[model samples]
Each structure stands twice: as C-alpha cells, then as structure tokens.
Target: MIRMQRLIPTGDPARPVEFTEDAQPVPAPDEALIRVEAFAPNRGETFLLERPEPGLMPGKDVAGLVVQAAADGSGPRVGTRVVGHPPRGGWAEYAAVPTHSLAELPDSLSAVDAAALPLAGITALRLLRTAGSVTGRRMLVTGASGGVGHYVTELAAAAGAEVTVVTATPSRAERLRALGAATAVHAVAGARGPFDVVLESTGGADLPVALSKLAAGGTLIWFGQASRTPATLDFFDLLSGPEGAVIRHFHYAGPNAGPNAGPNAGPTYGRDLATLVRLVHNGRLHPEIGRTADWSKTAETLVDLRERRIRGKAVLTTGVVS
Candidate 1:
C-alpha cells in the first residue's frame, strides 16, 4: 500500500483537524484517482467537522491532475487536469473521484480557481435553472457576500435580471454590485421588492422578510440557513405575502437534481461542472475566491469561515501538483 499525507479530525474543538499519513486510495471502476492540488472549504462542511463523526473526513470540492483514469474508461485520460466533487475525503494528497462528478479543466484556469467552482457554483447553477428565465425578472439575493450568493447574483445579473443584494457592510455591498447587482443594501428592509425570484439562504428573522418581498406567483428558493437559527413563519407571515407565491426547498443532492436540477431532466455533476467551466473560459462567469492559504491552515481557516471573517470561497493549496 502506498502511504499518502492527508488531514484528519482530532476530535478536539480547539484543534479540530490534524495531518496524518494514510494509504493511497484505490479508484473504483467508475472513479478516477486524482493527485489533488487544491480544495475549498465551506461553512456547512466546517460546521460538521467541529464535532465530527467517528470516521468522517472533510472535503467536498477539489481540483488536480488525474493520476489514473477510471478503470471502465468513463472519464478523462490519465494526466488530465480536472476539478471534482467527491462525496468526502478531498482534503488529501490524493482522492478517488467518481467520474460522473468530475470535469476536465482548461489550461487557463488555475487549480485554486477550479477548486472554488464545485459545491457553491453547482448550487447556484441548479437554483438558477429551477428559477427558469431571469432575463428580465426581478431577483433578490440574501447572504450575498458568501460564495453561493456571489454566484447567484452574478449569473442572474449576466442573464439580464435586476438583482437587489442584501449585505451587512459597505465593502461587501460594493463587491456585490461589481459582481452585477443592480442594487446593494445593508438589510433586507432596505430592498424595495416585488421580486419575481428570491434566493433566500440566510435563515432566521430575514427569511420571512424575503418571503414578503416576492411578487405574486413568484418563486423563492430556500437553500441554506447560515444564521444557524430556525425560521419561524406564522399564518400572518404566509398570508401577508403575495398570493400564489411559492417556496421551494433546494438540495443539490435531491432525487430530481441532476445537471440542471430544474424542471428539465438529465442531471449529471460532470455536465453541470462542465457548463460552469465553459462559462469561466468564455468570460461569462467568474468564480469569486476571497481567501487562499496553504493546506496546513485547515483548522484556523475553518475558524475564520465560521466567524464570518472570510468573504467568499476559501481555497487551500495542497502542493501536490504545481
């Protein structure tokens, strides 16, 4: 067995993760073996790591070079540069990635940038697909400073939607606007809306306000609860909003969630990632990576992410590939 260095949980809150040597993974017939160059940390994954399960390993989004192609010849050939979404264990020197959840990267895109595109980018893509055409719609995005929010705002704006973003500070407000927001305000209360579509991720008190902003028959996609507080919705909260308004709970891994995760069919993670990469290559979509650091700082990085110190995606370089 070939031993490789990887990050593992320490079961200590103050030092939640530490590095260790583990046997290199063998790829499944439908999975490719990757020499991981970089990975991105997400708040949701970090929260789980804070009190990790006995065998849990943290990692979701990664980018690197394929050391071995899928045994069944399902994905890119060996030596291909790729970005991938593995179920877990991505914070390692090597990871076995399912072919369907991997996509090749262009030479122009760096491993760090490609690493930023998986979980958040795909979530944004599927949600936008579910909302249908934003070409002339009014869209409101809460929690607009985070990775998913940035993608939602930029993609909607690029599609000709009028985007009103809610952030907490002037700096973030400015960044949101530069990402294509038509308007940026300090609070949801500052947004005057009869929005055709609303992407509500920050839960707690703000969720009801986001609901109230939707136009009649408009859609509100609820994907996250970054506030870590449950939303309380009363009969009045529902009745006060426009009639026929819809609230759709979004899960990137839902049964019907495929490449599009919309009303359309045929969802594959590879195809969805490919679309995002193509958009990046064509200068149509830009992945906003706000923080980058060496892989040794995984524990501290998670702390910063939880404390709201990092603004967008947080990428870690593994130094496994140049």
Candidate 2:
C-alpha cells in the first residue's frame, strides 16, 4: 500500500492544519487521480481549518499531472498536466478530482500559476459575466487586495469598465491600479459612484454603503463578508436607494441565478477555469500570486492567509522543482 503526505486538521487551536501520511486515494468512476505538484490556498478553506472536523481533508485548488485516468473514461488522460478543484483532500500528493472540475494546462503555464487560478479565478469570471458588458460603465470593487477582488478589477477593466476599488491598505492600492483599476480609495465613501455595477466582498458596514453607490438600475453582487461582521440595513434606507437596484447573492459554486437571470446562467467551474488558463497563457489575464513556498509551509502560509497577511493568491509547491 502506498502512502502520501497530506495536510489534515489537528483539531488544536494552537496549530489547526498539520501534515500527515495517508493512504493513496482511489479515483471515482468520474474522477481522475492527479499527482499534485502545487496547490493554492483560499481564504474560506483556511478559516475552516481553524476548527475543522476530524478526518476532514481541506483543499480546493490544485495543479499537477494525471497519474490515473478515470474509470468512466472522462477528463484528461494519464500523463496529462492539469489544474483542478477536488471537493476535498487536495492538500495531498494525490487527489481524486471530478472530471467536470478539471482543465488541461499548457506547457507555458507553471503548476504554481495554474494552482492559483481555480476558485478565485472562476469566482471573478462568473461575477463579471453576471454583471454583463462593463464597457464604459462605472464599477466599484471592495476588498480589492484579495484574490477574487483583484481578478474582478482586472477583468472588468480589460473589458473597458472604469473600476474604483476600496482598500484601506495603501500599498496594495497601487498594485490594484496596475491591474487596471482606474482609481483606488482608502474607503468606500471616497469613491465617486452611482456605479453601474458593484462586486462587493468586504460586506459588514460597507455592504449598505456599496449598495447606496449603485446606479438607478444597477446590480450589487454580494459574494463574501471578509469583515466577519453583520451588515444591518434599515428597510427604508434600502427602499430609498436607486430604483430597480438589485443585490444578488453570489458564490463560485452555486445556482448562479436569481429572479432576473442573465443571458448566461453562468459558466461551469471547468469551463471558466479553462478560459482563465487561456487568458493567462495569452498574457491577457494575470493571476496575482503574492506568495509561493514548499507545501511543508502550508500551516504558516494558511495562518498568514487567515489573518489577511497574504495578498492575492498563495501557491505552495509539493517539493517538485519542475
């Protein structure tokens, strides 16, 4: 029996995520077995690690080579390099990834870069698609320093939207501008808006303020509450805002639709990932990788990510130089 090194929850507050040896995983009929070379950390998964359930494996984004093809004859063939989202257990040497969640990687793309594109990339892609054509429109994005936030800013800007991002971090603001944000303000109030679209993630007190900045018929897509605070809005205040204004709930994996669905229901996880990868290959999209280290540093890396110390996406190589 072959064993692989994987990360698991220790269940101790002092150190939640730790490394362990586990038996190699077997692929499901519709899942391919990937020998992971690198993986990226998302903020949500790191939070779960702080008090994870026993036997819970935590990982969503990974890039590597296919070691075994799926029994059902789906996805990339063995020996193909790919990037994927395994529901869980991706922080291991091998993962059983569903075919629908995987995409082939080009030779020009490194495992580290590809690993950074799954969850965050897909979320940003879908959000922008939901907002429709941003060409010449005013848009505002909160939490611009985060993985998903930066992607939204860049993609919207590329499509010709005038993007204004809110971030208290002065240093990160400059980086956001280079990614195509027309302006970066220290607070939501600093923004000059009535924006046609708003991709808000920082929530809390900023949620309602963001809503207030929307144009008459604008859409406000609420995706996350990184502030970890509740947003309280008065009924009258909401009613007083722009007419036909909407606040749609969004998630990377979900129904991706509401009362008024867009022409596209939304792109699939695998489909969006492929688009992101192609954009990256063509230099049309850049994955803002803020940190890269060996997989052994996952615990420390995750801690930095949880505390919001790390910017953009964090990638960890599995001791594979090539």
Candidate 3:
C-alpha cells in the first residue's frame, strides 16, 4: 500500500484531504511504478470530484523517479528522471502510470517546472501546431491569463502570429503583453476577432461572443471551462455566417497531449507529452504559473481557484509555493 492523498469532495476545497496511509495500485504490462516526488491537478479534477466517477483518480500531472520496470521492458527502467500526466494517481506518493505518458525530464528543468509541463504545455503546443498560417494571423486567446491560454499566447506569438488576448482581469493585461500578445483587452472589450484560432480556455456567457469573433473559416479549440457556469451556443449561429467557421472541442486529456506523455493505452491517456517537455527545454513554450500549493495546502488553493481568483495556473506542489 502506498501513502496517498485523496479529496473527499464535499463542495469545499479548504477542507483537508483524506490521508490514506496505504493505497494499492495494479500496474499493467505497459506501465511504470513511479516514486512520486510531486504532482498537480488541473481544474478538471475538481469538477470530477463533484461528479464522482469510479476508478478515476483525480490528479493528472506528476514529476517523479521510476521505481520498477515491467517484464516486457515496456516502462522506463528504475531511476529514470521522468515527468508525466497519468490518468490518475497524481496526488499520491506512488503511482502506476502508463509508460506511454512518461518522458525524460530534461537536465535543465526543476521538478516544479516539470510538474507544470504536461497538461497546459502540450495543450498549447497542439493548439499552435494545428493553428494554420500563424505567421501574421490574428489570434485571440480567451482566458489569456490562465495556464493553457497564457502559453497559447506565448507560443503563437513566437510562431509570428499577431496575438490579441482576452482576459478577465485588467491587471493581467500587461502580463499578457509581456507574453507576446500584441494587445490585451479586459472582459468588457467590445467584440474583437477575426482570429485565426481562438483558444477557448474559459467558458460561460462570454463564450459565444468569443467564438463569434473568429474570422470566416477560423477554428476554436475548447480546452477548459473555468467558469462553473455552463455555455449555451446554437450550432447554426457558429456554423452559418459570412465567415462560416469550424470548432474543435479540445480537452488535453488525450494521448498526444504533452511534450512527453506518449502513445497511451487506455481510451483517454495516450499523447506525446514529450514534445511539450522538449519545447520547455528548448524555450518555445513558457507557462505563467501564478501560484503553487503543497500537498499540505492544495485544498485551500483549489477552493481559491473554484472561486475565480486564479490569474494563472495554480500549481499544487509537495514543496511550498514560496
């Protein structure tokens, strides 16, 4: 049994998580036994807890060392420096993760930075990769100050895309500009668009309007919904327009998601997260991590995130946020 932390979801993040002294995990043939040094969870984990799903261990990202190798040599050998986003077991001290999702942690990255790479980094990478003609293409990233959207602004700008960002906080405007966004508009900014690709990281009332800003044939990838509020969109409204466009609902929970998490096996876990790690290693993708929490205090911050106070990624750490 492995010592682990589990959220006993009761609609409150401030409450201390249940400490499980012993949790057992079964490793499949293509899995690795990782000695989890530190890990973090995305916003999805919170929502997931509200709507319980059996066998779904909430936390997804991890930075750790390997402890065991399988008979088929399907996983990284023991003692490999690795980081990954597993389908589950991220908040635990030990996790049995698919080898496909693991990537070698670069010599340059600390465990804290490695912990930030998987979910947000790869989402930005894929969004940039599929976003066509980014060179001089007008781009708008909703929730531009958040984890994934912030990186989208950075990578898109580096790709020579003229970036326009939409953020909830006015103070985040300067930060967005620093990340290479050509301009930053507060939530009240009038309908602005003609964006080649809109990274839909925030969902709610402004969602449809943001989608409307996409130029004809423009694409929008919906990766996250920070607003507890739901969206109401008419397909025809988006589908029929002078600038008739396309929309791709993107959730980074897939196989080719990060710079390292590789060809996964389960229905939802395989993605090349390694490519994301490589970018951070090469300096193409930089995530604006606004806050971090230790396993000791993540519950408190998660509540803060749920309350809409998070300006950038709120990373949960085994180490303090200082």
Q: Pick by TM-score: which candidate is best?
A: 1
List, residue by residue over 97-155, the lDDT tens digit for candidate 2: 99888999999999999999998888888788778889999999998898898888888
Cα lDDT tens digits for candidate 1, 1-322: 9999999988776677899999999999999999999999898987787788898988989999999999998999989999999988999999999999999999989999999999999999888887889999999999999999999898999999999999988999998899899999888888999999999999999999999999999999999999999999888769877999999998877755565444655435898899889999999888888789999998888888887899989999986765
Residue 296 of model 3 has an lDDT of 70
| Ranking of all candidate structures by their TM-score, best first | 1, 2, 3
Task: Order the candidates by lDDT, highest first.
Answer: 1, 2, 3
| Regions of model 2 farther than 4 Å from truth | 257-268
Whole-model lDDT, model 2: 0.87
TM-scores, all models, native as reference? 0.96, 0.95, 0.85
Error of 2 at 305 (Å): 0.6
Model 1 scores worst on lDDT over the 10 consecutive residues at 259-268
Q: lDDT tens digits, residues 1-322, model 3?
A: 4445454445434552454555656678888877777676666666665555555556778888887875568757888878877877677767788887788876787667778777777677766655656887888777776677777888888889888887767679888888898888876246366777777767887778888788887887777777767989987876665275777776555554433436762433234567667777888767567677677777777766656677767766664221
Instruction: Assess each prediction's global lDDT (C-alpha) against the native.
Output: 0.90, 0.87, 0.70
Q: How far is candidate 3 from the true structure (C-alpha RMSD, Å)?
A: 3.7
Better of 1 and 3 by TM-score: 1
